[model samples]
Target: MLDQKLFRHPETLSALSDSLARRGFALEVNRISALENHRAELQSKTEQLQAKRNETSQQIGIIKAQGGDIQPLLDEVAGLGDALKIDQAQLHDVQEQLQAIYLSIPNVLDDSVPDGDSEDDNVESHRWGELRHFEFTPKAHPDLDKIGLDFESAAKISGARFAVLKGGLARLHRAIAQFMLDVQTQYHGYTEVYVPYLVSGEAMRGTGQLPKFEADLFKIEGKVAGDQDFYLIPTSEVPVTNLARDSIFDEQDLPQKYVAQTPCFRSEAGSHGRDVRGLIRQHQFEKVELIQFTKPEDSFDALESMREHAEAILQKLKLPYRVVTLCSGDIGFSASKTYDLEVWLPGQGQYREISSVSNTLDFQARRMKARYKNKQTGKTAFIHTLNGSGLAVGRTLVAIIENYQEADGSITVPEALRPYMNGMERIQL
Candidate 1:
């Protein structure tokens, strides 16, 4: 949510309008201005009526003390009360209208974000490791041999965009998640967290997933009467970042880092035919998520560090990958800037996104009312929120399977995961 103060300054509002335009959002400047003006008028009227009512009540008290007739004063106060109610109602309605518009607005793009219309326009930052040259034609994860990547059974139970891994393959998936959690918690200085997979609508909204992207969520209606709907988390980011919602931290607690592994559920409403074959896109997927809340000025730097933390997992696994700076139009709704880590997949013979690190720059914090007190100024202000996929467990499994497949179809487990896999170096049928 943008600061309401931004609307008060014509220059800042215009600049914000321009920035939103670059993200392909058309700000209704005229409508916003009109609504704001009407809100101001109504609020002023409400305040004046309130003040007048107080003054009239005082006058009535004085008149009674003097033994004078108070009926006329009583009548005048009743009329004033009626008028005040009307103005107050109008003010409330206008404020709600303004809030809806504000909630719908995307965050302003960072100055450094490049202008572009699509992912094709995103700029590559750098690459790591070398793409492997296959002795034979590399096969996609779904087509690879016997190490259990079951889809038929999953379909019988749960329909499309779902899979069930068994045997060594399932263990490998668990191993990958464990390795990521250990790396994020032990080396990267992030506190490990266990978050509920189901969260409230407000929690979803706090992380910028509700109202606009509600279509992409799995909403569970309460079984009992009058129960609020619960949504299966789209990412651990939703619940983990929301830990700071409606909270105020002291300056020494300026940065809070948390990591969690969760099974994310998404409706995938807009993606109909894309990546329908494998785990690349799933209705349910496991992800290791990283979240941070930081002082506003330090968020961008924290974003870079978070990106590096994600990259460390790929490097340790010896996976080839590249980082790309997302263009304005390609960025997420709540992110001021984003960097995507695209890991090399031999099966697809191309790079595919495995993680995205973003700095929301108080975008989520404003919605969540997450703030910190400034020690020097002794004032409270919204903190900056950042989230990233330390790595998607399923995608990393896909990468390892394709990249480590032997000529005979056995997979040589990445050394980094060997400890978690109980020193079992290879997974074979």
Candidate 2:
């Protein structure tokens, strides 16, 4: 959401052009220039017409006051009014066209971001702990036989991409969410929040979810219990990050930390074939989201701290994981830079992302108009926004099931969660 005026300015445009080009987004400079030219022309014509109409109206008033035939002045004023109307219409058209271009223009990526197209191109920053070498062949998660958990039954009850965890399994899932929330709020300096599961289109747009990824949301059909076009939230981050929308904050309160556990829902329309068997991907899952609002200078520090906060959960649980920096194209629409914490999943025989931490800079804050005032300059500026999954609750469960599995088919509950699980050390079925 860089200013359109800056894109038009020669010096600013050159720096922006170089930054975007390095990040692999060939800025549509020509199209933007054409739209800007049309807007400039239309605005000039509108201003001139408005000035002429005002002067002619004053002349008509004077003629009528003088008791003279006002037809000639009236006719001239009427022609000016018509021209003004035409100018107004053209102004409206050109403004709309310019706005369309502005809205579509993406934020320039950070130079630190690696140039790549997909998840595979992301850089592996660092990894912790070693994978346990099992003497027996590891079984896939769907083949888990000891636990009463059944994905097939879940599918039968609620179609594909659903999961059913009854008895101890349900308790364990809840325990994981509580554990993540506790660590984030109590240890990591995040204020806990409980947000609405449903949100408006504006909230989604503020987070860069609409227009491009409408297929991934569960939009409520028709009118709900109340009159509103609400979408089931895909993440708690949507509401939490939007807390500062259209508001200004004090500089002292610059970095705001928020943590929330909510049930997230996603249609995930495009991921039709992948992870079809278990909790690796699901329609509804619980998550503890971490969101931060900070000054531009403090954003990168916030990013690393958020990543470590996510890693702390796994480390406490004794789950092996690695941190990775997401490449340019693989990063989300609003993220200038991102880090993903991928926990080791023995069942999948590879690392899978359990949390994604991103420093969005001012991209989302600008879109949401969230800002803070500099006391010295008396100027309000967009705050940098960052959000990360402390851990995706359902995927954490999957990782635990896979990574902490025993050769005998029973699952060992991670030590950190044992206290939450009533001192239980294993799930023996």
Candidate 3:
């Protein structure tokens, strides 16, 4: 949610709308303006009526004490009370309308974000590692031999966009997640956390996922009566970042870092024909997520550091990848700025996104009421929040299969993951 103060001034609100326009979001400025005006009028009327009622009541008491007729004064007071109630209700309704508009507005793009319409316009930051050249034709993960990557069984059990891995392929997927968790926690100084895969709608709203991206989510009804419905988490970002919801941290706690490993569920709505062949696009996938809460002044720097943290995992695994700064139109709703890490896939003959690190600034903090108290000023202010995928486990597994394939159809394990695989160097049929 945007700061209410921004909407209080027409110039600021217009500026915000213009900023969001760069992201292709059409903010209804005129509607908000009208609502604000009506809210102000109703509030003023309600206050005036209350004041008049109080005065009339005092007059009635005085007249009755002097033994004069006070019925007229009593009647005026009753009318004022009814009018005040009506005005108060009107005021409440307008305020709710304004809040709904604010909740739907996305974060303003950072100045550093490039202006572009889509992913094609995103600027590449840098490239890491070297893309391997294969002597034979590279096979996509689905075409790789043995190791049991089954989509047929998964489709039978749970329709399309789901997969079942067996033997070495399954272990490789687990190893990738464990390796990412260890790297983020041990090397990146992030505290390891286990978060819920199902969260409340409020928690989703707190993270800027509800109201806007609801169609892309999976909602589950509660089995017991009176229990609130829960939504399956699209990412660990929801529960991990919501840890700071309605919290006030001391100045010394300016930066809080946490990493979580969880299975993410997404409806993949509107993505009917893209990446439907393999693990590239799945209804359910595992990801190691990194989250940080920091003072406003330190968030951009934290964003860069977080991006490096994610890049380090690919570097350790020696996977060829590149980083790109997401353009305004390509960024997420809650993020002010974002960097995506795309790993090379020999099978696809191109780089695909494996991780995305974002600096949401105070966009999510304002929604969650997550704040920090300043030691010097003794005042609380919204905290900046950031989240990123350290790496997508399924995608990493895909990269390993495609990048490490041998002429004999066996897969060589990346050295970093060899220990996790019990010193096994090659996986063959």
Candidate 4:
């Protein structure tokens, strides 16, 4: 959202000079430059009381058209309409506190990122294939705890990080979310939506997931006692990037593209004990996201073509991935450049992040105003949003069950998901 006139301008500290240490973001851009100098001094005292109430409405229409005494110009136009209604209600409370601090600041990085603060300063950038060396000493997806992979019956029906999948591993986790929604909708053209896993806290503050990742999400409510309910999305990039929330497209729809698969939920609340085993970190999973809406000069080339459509589903399931690029504190909240991808697990030898690709340029389309139009100067701007993870369908089913496992343990069904598993190759019982 970052545009309260670029919080104290100077191009918002040179556009957050590459995510000022990733996502700490210059202490919230120095607290939105002190609320943009109190909304530019109450917008110059409300434009000097609307130019002294339009010159006191032309001196009360020339003092009642010069008829005898017009009560001394109506007592100076009733004291300039009570001081122009207190400088227009203090310039509408300093432009609603400078739109609650620049629509909740974010986005502004991309200077070849790579700084540092968290995620071990995240900056791997490349490395693809070469881990599977398990000569009979591998087994780690909770050691497939009894064939159907129950996970203590999903922690006794929904307790710790839930997971249930029965039979052929719930058809291999629903064929890895229908093979990542048919490869992100027929080979990366994206558009296959379904949305709404419950949203609206202004669509999770238009994608930055509200006032600081709301402790990694999961909310829901029937509203009341203290209001502000609704939540439970955590991804589908919060309802496919709020489907252009406030709307205004048409620069030939610049570059809409979308894709869903849904069920995300999260609330991993500070990741308590981190990756507490199996399906690594989860509070409900299933993904396939990949939103977009380009046009800030095509958002860093649509984040390198959505990170090559999540590395073309790990190069058509031959797996072995790597792509990284997220430094500047492991970029994310309304990213201004990111990459991720990761994959190549092989019993967790390393590389994980199953897809990311970002570029949130217009910072969530100026907080969901989501505009477009500028076809060679037609005007209407704000449109850079993006979202990714064209994978994450349960971490690509835990990176295809630890990279096509198989020490006679059976798993191999990858040739682009064996035609969505109907003609599956392996996953033996």
Each prediction's TM-score against the native? 0.98, 0.92, 0.96, 0.36
lDDT of 3 by residue, 145-211 (tens): 5767889999999999999998887888888899999888888899999888889999999999989
TM-score-sorted candidate list, best first: 1, 3, 2, 4
The stretch of ten residues in a row with the least summed lDDT in candidate 3 is: 220-229
Model 4 lDDT-worst window of ten:
17-26
- What is the total number of backbone clashes in candidate 3? 0
Tens-place lDDT digits, model 1, residues 214-327: 999999998433798899999999999999999999989878999999999999999999999989999999999999999999999999999999999999999999999999
Candidates, ranked, lDDT: 1, 3, 2, 4
Residue 18, candidate 4: how far off, in angstroms? 14
Over 56-152, each residue of candidate 4 has an lDDT whose tens digit, in order, gives 6787788678765667667876786787788678778767766765555566687787777776777776766666666775565667554466777
Work out how many backbone clashes candidate 4 has: 3
lDDT of 2 at 288: 92
Off by over 4 Å in 3: 54-74
Give the Cα lDDT of each candidate.
0.93, 0.85, 0.91, 0.75
**Model 2 over residues 257-372: C-alpha lDDT tens digits?**
99999999998898979888888888999999999999999999998899899999998988899888998778877788889999998877889999999988888887799999
In candidate 4, which residue ranges exceed 4 Å CA deviation?
Answer: 1-42, 46-81, 93-106, 113-124, 128-164, 167-203, 210-227, 233-263, 266-321, 326-333, 336-341, 345-393, 400-404, 407-429
Cα error, candidate 4, residue 239 (Å): 18
Better of 2 and 3 by lDDT: 3
Tell me the spans in candidate 2 whose CA falls farther than 4 Å from its real position: 10-18, 21-26, 55-78, 225-228
Q: List RMSD in Å for every model shown.
A: 1.0, 2.3, 1.8, 18.0
Q: Which model scores highest in lDDT? A: 1
Considering lDDT, which of the candidate structures 2 and 4 is the better prediction for this target? 2
